[model samples]
Target chain A: MSRTSSDAVVVHQREPFLRGFGSFVADVWAARTMLVSFVRKDLMIRYRGSALGIAWTMVKPLVQLLVFSLVMGYFLGFGDQIPAFGFYMFTGLMLFGLFADQLTGGATSVLWGAPVVKKVAFRRELLPLAAVGGALVNFTFMGVVLLLAYVVTRDFPNWHMLGLAVPALLITVLFGAAGAMLVSALNVYARDVQFLIDVGLLLMFWLTPVLYPWSTVQNTLAENGAPSWAFELYMLNPMANAVVAFQQALWPGVDEAVANAAAQRAAGEPFIADFDYFDSAFATRLWLMVLAGAVCLWFAQRVFARLQTGFATEL
Target chain B: MAADVLEPGVAVSVEGVTQEFSLRHEKTLKGLLVSRLRGRHPVAERFRALDGVSLQVPTGSTMGLIGHNGSGKSTLLKIIGGVLTPTAGQVRRRGSLAALLELGAGFHADLSGRENVLLNAELLGLSRREIAARFDDIVEFSGVEQFIDTPMKFYSSGMFVRLGFAVAIHAEPDVLLVDEVLAVGDEQFQAKCLGVIRRFQQEGRTIVLVTHNMGDIEAFCDEVTLLHHGVVRAQGTPRTVVAAFRGLLAEDERERRAQSAGGRDDPEDPDLGFVRVARVVVRAGSGRPLDAFVAGDSLVVEATFHAERPAPRFVGTLDLYEGGTLLHSTSTARLGVPVGPLEGEVTYRFTLPDVPLGGGRYRIAVGAAPDTGSPPWHQVGDAAEVMVALRAESSGPFALGVTVDRPTRV
Candidate 1:
C-alpha cells in the first residue's frame, strides 16, 4: 500500500484500462468519508420537509403491499386457497422495491450530482455508489416492515429462514449496485439511457414474478407442453430467483397443497403439486445468481472507471 | 530569468500541459444522430485551450496568472488544481492542495451554511474531526454566524462566497489555487481576505492566483505569468509581466479600432458638413515631441482640424484615457479657450502647467464638434500615447503631493 503524504500531491493525465481502475478504487477508499457524507445528505434531503419524515420509507412499501394484496385477494378473489397470501406478496414487493429504487437512483446519480462532478476532484464512482447506499438504507426500513407483516400474519420465521434471507438480500443489493453503475456511466453521455432504464424496470417487474407466485408461471408452462428452455430462461433473471428466495425465507410453512389449489383456481389451471423452494436445485440456482451478481459488479466497475475520465468535461 | 530555475524545493511543477476540448455542434443524441445521417461530423471544432504550457513554482512563492478572457489562465489553474486533466503532459505538486477555482463551486444551495461548510471541508480533504474543530472559527471568519443554520439558497451571493472562502482557507492547505473570486463581498471583507492570503504567504505556503486586477498582482505576486492565445507570452517579475500584458491589450485595441475604421460605417448618418479632427499631437514645453514624461512636467496637446464646409464656430476636445476608462477631458468651450470661425484647416493647442498623473501608459481621444450643440463631426479614439514615470507611490487615478507635520508633544 502506498502511504499518503500531506506534503506531496502528484497529478497526472489519467491512464486507461486496469491501471486506472485500481487507482480509482483506491481513491474512493481514501475518500470514504465523502461517500458516507453524500449518502447521509441524500437520505436526509429526500425526507427533509415531509411531515412523516423517514417513516415514509416504510409507509411507501407497506401501502403498496396492502393495495396489491387487497385487490388480488378480495376483489379478484384468490385469497381462499393460499394461506397467508398477504405475507407471500409482501416479501416479493419489498425486495422489488429495493431493486427498483437502486436501479433508478443509481442511473441518475451522475446527472443529479452535476454540480459536484463538474467542480470537485474526487473518485466519480462514489456518486452512483452513494445512490446505491441510499437505496439500501431505505431497503433496510422496508425489511423491518416485511418482518412485521410476517409476524402479524402468524408466519414465524425459523433458522433456515435466516440463512436464506441474509444471502438473498445481499445478492439483491449487489445486483442492483452493479446495474446502477452500468446505467449511470452510460447515462452521462447519452441521457436516453435514463428513460430506457425506467422502461426496463417496468418490463423486469412482471418478468420477475413479484406480484404472482413463480409456481403459477411454472404450471402454465408445464401444461402447455412448453420447451424446457422457457422455464430455464425465465429463471435466468437474477431478480426472479431473488424474489423466490425472499418469499421462501419470509413465508415459512407455505402449505404446499393450499397454495397449489389456490393457484389452480385463480388461473383456471393445474399448478405444480410439489414445489420445494429450499431444495438443492433451487439453492444452486440462487447461488448461481449470486455469482452472476458479482460478475456484473466487476464489469460495472470497469465500465465506470473508463467512462468517468470524461465526466468533468461532459458535465 | 533567475526565477526560472527548478530547485528541489519546488512546490508545483507543470510540464508540457496541453488541454483540448471538442466543440460539438450537437449536444443531444437526436441532433447527433441527425448529423450522422447527414454525413456531418458531430464535432464542429477542436479548441486547444492550453498548448504545451510549462512553469515551476518554488516553495513559498506566490505566482500570478494574468491574461485576457479565454487566454487559458483559468484552464491552467484548473489543471494544476486537479479539477481538469490535460490531454498531454502532467502537473505534479508537493503539498496538500486546496483550490477556490470558482466561488461556491461545490456548495449545495438547498443545504444550510453549516452543512455546506462541513461538506465542502471534507471534499477539500479535511477529516470530520478537523471540520468539527474548526467549525466555529470558520463561521466566525465568514461573519455569517447568525445565519449559519439558514439554507444557502436564502443567503445572499456575497454570503455564499464568504462562507466558501472561509472553509477553503481553514482547510490549512499547503498549496492554494485561487481564481478571480476575491472580487466579491464588501471592500472590508476583500481586505480581510487579502490579509489572510498574505498571512498564508508569510507562513511559507505556495499560492497561485488568477486575477485581472493589475494592482493585486503588483502587490501580492512574487512572480507573474502572462498568457496569450493559449501560450505563455511572458513570465518573470510582476513589473515585466504586467508591462507585457498592457502591451498585448494596446495592440489588441489598436487592431480592433483599425478594423472598425476600415469596413464599418453607419450609412444612415451622412457625414456632417462641418469641421472634423484630423490629427493630434503631444509635446513637452521644450518644443519636443514626447511619448514619455515624468510627473509635474509641463505638457501640451495640439489638435488640428479640417473644415470641409464653412462653420460659424467650432470646438475641439482633447480627452486623456487609461485603457478604456476616460480620465480627463478639456474642451475649448469648457476650458474658456477662444475659437474663431472655422474654415479650411486650423490648429489649436491646449497646455497643462504640470502633468498631474502618475506612472502608467495612457492614450488621447480627440473630437471636433460645431458650436451648434450637435454631435461631434468626427471622433478619433487612440489619437496618441503617453507614459508617465512614477515619482512617489500613490493610488487612485492620478498622483498628488502630500506633506505631514508632527507635533512635538501629543
Candidate 2:
C-alpha cells in the first residue's frame, strides 16, 4: 500500500462560529460510505427476524388504508361526496408518515449510536442523516404500494402535476433534517427533548392538512371571518404544503371536485366544496418555503457542529 | 489559529492542550428548573483533566504514558486522537490516525462479525476497497473464521476482542493511539498483538500508548512520560522515567500509611515512651542504601532504637513480609546476638547472605521486646520496603536457579 503525500493533516481545536463549515462539509462528504453502511445496518436490523421480512414495510400502510377506507367510506356516508376518499386521505398520511418517522428516528439517532459515537472519530452528522435515509426507504415502499392501489382502482392521477411531488418531498426532507439535527444534539444534554418531540409531533399531526383536505380549513377560516393573511399563514406550514402537493400528484379526484364545485355554484345548487389545487401564489410560496427550509437546515447544522464538541464528554 | 509548523521528524505535536469538563449538578431538566425556581442556582463543577500538557511524538517512535488513575493519560490520548476537542490549545497531527481506545467500541452486538468488521474498519478511516482487500487477512488473524457470520453477542469475550483488535490493526493508520487495550485476551493473543505492533514499528509508524502495566511500557516504549495528577512529572528514557514513577508510587504509599494513623501508630501502649524503634533501613553489601535489588543479593537490615530509661535484656526482632504475609522471621536472641543494657539510642544490624526472593516489593518490620515471652517495648509494622528483581527468567515468591544434566536415554 502506497501512502499518499497529500494526506490531509487535521488540526483539532474548539472551532469558532461558522469558521470550519467548508472542512466540516468536506469531512461529511468523505464519510458518505460510512453513512450508507449505517443506513443499511438500520434497515436490515429492523426486519431481521420477522417471517415476512421486507414485506412488513408495505403491510403497515396497506392495513391503515384498509381500516380508513372501511370506516370513513362506508360508515360515514361521505363516499358519494368525495371520489376515492380513503385513497386521498392515505396519500396525505403516507407523506406525513415519512416526516414523522424521520423526526422521531432522527431525534434519538445520536443516543442510539452512542457506542460508536463515543469511540470513533467520524462525521457525527451521519447518525441523523442515516435515520433520514432509513425513513426514505420506508417511504419508497409505501409509494409502490400506493401505485398498486391506483392501478387496481383504474384511476390514474394527474400526470401533469406529479412533478410537484419531487419538490414537495425535498421540502419535507429538509424540514425533517433540520428538526433532526437540532433535537439530536440537544437530546445528548437533556433526555427530555425526546419526550417533548413526541408530544409536539402529535400536535403537528392535527395542525397539518393530513386527515382533512386544505379546502375544509379554508372554508372554516372564511366562515369565521378570518383575514386573508391568516390563510397565507396557515399554508406557511411545510407539512401542509407537502400534503397538498401529494394530493395534487396522487389523488385523481382533485380537478374533478374543483370542476364540480364550479358547476354547482353556477347552477345555485348545494355542492361539496373543494379549493384550487394550484392557487395563484402556490409555486412562489412552495419554492420560497424550500429556500426557508434550506436556511433552517443550515442553521441547525451549525448548531449541531458547535454542540457536538461536547457530545463525547457529555454522553 | 495560525497553522502549526512542525519539525521535520515530528509526526504528532500537541501544543499546550488543556481539557476541562463541566459537571452539571442537575441531571434532568425538571430538576434543573425546580432548583432554579427556588432561587438556588446549581453551579457546574469544573474539573481540569489535563492542564497545559504538551508533548511531541517523532515519526516512527513509540511513546508510553504512565500515571496513576485519573492522571489524564487517557484524556491526553483522546485529545491526540481527535476524539475530544481540547477546551484550550490545539493538537496538530499529520497523516491518518486511529485510536484503539476500547476493543470492540464500534462493533454492533446484533450484527455479524463480517458486517461489523466492514463497519468498524470504515469507522477507523479505512476505505471500502481497503477493507475488502484486507478482509480475509483480518479474519485469519483473528482466528474466528469459523464464526465470522455469527452475531457478536454470541461470541466469547476473547473472540470479540480478538476480532476487534484484528480489524483495528489492519486499518493501516500512520499514527495509532492505544489506551491500555493491549492486555486483552489470553497470553498467546497478547503476544501476537505485540508482534504486530513490532511490525508496525518496523514499518515506521508512530505510536502513543497509555497503560498501567509498566512491563509493557518498558518492553515496547522507546521513551516514557509520567503524569501525576494531570501534570507531567518526568519525561525521558524509559528507565529514568519509570524509576521516577516508582518513587512517586512509594511516596503515595507512605502518605496513605501516614493518613491511617491508628494502624501506623500504636495508641494503647503501656510502656508509652520507655523505648521506641526509631527507624529501620536496608542496605546493600557495599553499604549503599537502595530500595531495589537483584535477587540473591546480600542485604543488611539495621534498626535503631531509643530508650528513655535503663532497660536490660532487650530483644530485637526483624521480620520480612510480602503483602501482609510473613515470609521470614529472625530475632537477636534467635541468632545468638545479645543487646547491652539499653539506656540510650542503640542500633542493631542483621546481615542476610544470598537472599532468594522474587520480583515484588517486600516490607520489613522491626520490634524491640523487653525480653523473650514479654510484650514488645516498641514495634513498627511497615518500617521499610525493598523491591527484588528476578535474577533469571523465573517467577513466584522465590527465584530459584535450576540446572539439569543432559539425559542419556535414562
Candidate 3:
C-alpha cells in the first residue's frame, strides 16, 4: 500500500475539455520536453560517427551543388541563358533534398520506433518528430550553404531573404510533422508503407521543380502570350510552395553594394511577373503553405496522440 | 491511510487497472482477410492480459514481480514504469522513473560500443555531461573496455548485455523496473548484477524486478506480487507470495498430467489411462516438503504416473531440470522393469542422497513409452511440476564433491 505524499502527483483526466483545441494544447505542452529531448538526441546521433563528424552535416549539400554545377552547368550549357544558373540548380536540389529527407524519414518513424511503442510507453509522436528533427539539422546546414553561396556570388547579402526561408520552413516543418504522424500510425496497420514510401518519394521528386527551375517552364508558357495558368496546377503538389520560397530566398541577385553591376540585367527586379513563375505567382502560395502546414500539424499530432494510446496493445 | 503517511516521497500507486490484448485466431493470410471482411474489430478477438490489478510500494522498497511467462508480471511492471498505460485504472507516482525493461533496446548495431553507451544513456534521460561523467564507470562495470571502440555488431551477446546493463543501472532512476532473470549470459556478469541489486536495495530506492527465478525473489525483494493470468494472484512478503506462486505452478503441472491421461492405443478408458507421469515433487524425506534444500541433504525425486491397462516391458523416462536445463535423465526400463499395468497413478521416488545442484529453480518430467534402444528418445508420460529451491553453499561444474578446493598453505 502507498501513502499519498505531497510529492505523489496524480494525473487527473477530467470529464471533458471545453472543446477539441484545448486538449491539443495541453497534450503538446505536457509532452513538450519529451519532444525537445527526443529531437535533440536524433540530431546528435546522426552526426556522431562520421570521420568528418558534424562537418559532413554541411558537406552533403555543398558536394551536391558542386556535382550538379559541374555536370549540368558545363555540359547542358543552361548557364548562358540564366544568371549564375549553377546557383539556381544547386538551390533547387538543396531544398528538394531537405523536403525529401523529412517526408521519407518522418513517414517511417512510427514503423522504425515500433519497438519503443510496443515495449515502452512514451509520447509516440516524438518518434517521428525526432526523425524529422534529424532532417531539420540537415536543412539548417543546407540553409547556411545557401547563405554562403550568396557571400560568394551576390553583390551583398540581402537579409530579407531570411523571411522566405524562415516562414517557408515553418510551413515545411508542419507538413513533415503531419506526414510523420500519418505514416507512423499507418505503418502499424500495414507494413506495405515501409517500401511504398520510397516509390512515392521518387514520384514526388519528379513532380516538384527540384532539378529544373520554374522560370524555364514559364518561359515556354510566355510563347502562348500569357503566363501558363497550367503551371499553377503544379503548386497542388504540396511541397511546391516551399520550393517557391527557397527560390525567392536564394535567387541570384545584386543589392545596393553593386547596383551598377546589378543593372547589367535589371537587378532591381526579381523576375518578370507571371502567375506561372514561383516568384511572380499568385499571392496564395504563402497562405496556402500556412493553411496546409497548420492543418497538417494539428491533424498529425491529434492522430499520433490518439493512435499511440492503443499502440502497446495493438503491437 | 494517515495524512502524513500519504505525504511526499511515495514512489508509486496503481489501482483497479485492466489491460486486454487479442490473440488473432488464425495466423493464415486468408484468415486475416476473412476476419477483416466480417467487420470483427480487434475487440472481438482480444483477451484481457491484465485484470483489475492494483498495487502500491513505498518510496524506498525493492519489490519483486514473480510469475510465469504470460502471467502479466512484466505487463504490470511496464505499466508501473510508465512505459505503458493501462486500458483501465490509474497509476500515481512521485519522483523520476527509470526502466530497464529490455536492456539495449535502442542500441544501433552499426554504432561502436562507446557511441552506443552514450546514445543509450541519453535515450534513458541522462544528459551529455552526466554521460561523460559516468562513461568510465559504465565501461569498467561492463568489462568491455577492450572492445569499447569496436562496432557493436562485432560484440558478443554477453558484451551487448553488459553495455546495456551498465548504462541502465548507472542512470539511477528513483524507480527502476527490471524484467527477466540475469542468468542467461555469464556467471561473472550475473554476480555483478546481483551485487548491484543488493546495493540498490540497501539504498532504499524503489525497484520492481520481474524474474522467474525464485532465488532473485528471495535474495533481493522485500515483497513480491504474484501475477497469474493477467491478475494479481497474491501480494505479500517474499516468503508468503512465493509459497502462493509455487502452489499455482503445482496446480498447472497436475492439470497437464491429467490431460495426457489415457494410453495411446486405448482412448476409451479415461480412468484407466496411460502411465504418462503426473508430477515430480522434491522432498527431504522428512514428511514435509521444504521450500529449499540443505547443500548435502537427501533430495527425493518423486514421479507420479497413470497406467491405463496391463502392458509389456515399457520404459519410463525421468528428467530433472534446474533453471530449464536438463541435469540428468533416467529410465525405469534400464532397471529391468518387465511388465506393468497402466491402470492407476504410480509414484517413483529417487533419493539423490545429497543435493548436488547449485542454487536455482528446477522441474522434473516422467513419462512411459516403449523400449529405449535407438537413442532413448521416446517418451510417453510427459508431465512435470516446477520446483523452486535454493542450494546451500553449492559450487559449480558437475558435483565437484566439495565447494572449492583450497591449496595447501605452508
- Candidate lDDT scores, in order, read 0.78, 0.79, 0.65
Residue pairs of candidate 1 with colliding backbone atoms: A7-B95, A8-B95
Best-matching candidate per DockQ: 2
Residues B383-408, model 2: lDDT tens digits: 76677765557766787776677988
| Candidate 3 segments whose C-alpha is farther than 4 A from its true place | A1-6, A9-82, A113-121, A155-162, A194-238, A254-288, A310-315, B1-10, B22-40, B102-105, B264-410
Ranking by DockQ: 2, 1, 3
In terms of lDDT, the poorest run of 10 residues in model 2 chain A is: A1-10
Residue-level lDDT tens digits of model 1 in B105-143: 577777888888887898888888899999999999999
- Residue-by-residue lDDT tens digits, candidate 2, A273-296: 675754667767777878888888
Per-residue lDDT tens digits for candidate 3, residues A184-282, read 776665555656777887788777765555555565666667656676676676667777666656665313213433453475554432212334343
Candidate 1 TM-score, C-alpha based: 0.81
lDDT of 1 by residue, A1-315 (tens): 011234445675355554455666678788887999999887777788899988888886778777877887677665554556777777788888888888898888988777766666777788888988888888888777766766777667555555667668878888999888988888887788888899999899889876676766777898899997898889888888888788777765465544565576788764443335535777777777788888778778888877776677777
Question: Which number leads on TM-score?
Answer: 2
Between candidates 1 and 3, which one is better according to TM-score?
1
- What RMSD does each model have against the real structure? 6.6, 5.2, 7.2
lDDT of 3 by residue, B34-132 (tens): 888998888777788899998887778888888888888877877776666777887777755666665544466666788678756765677778989
lDDT value for candidate 2?
0.79
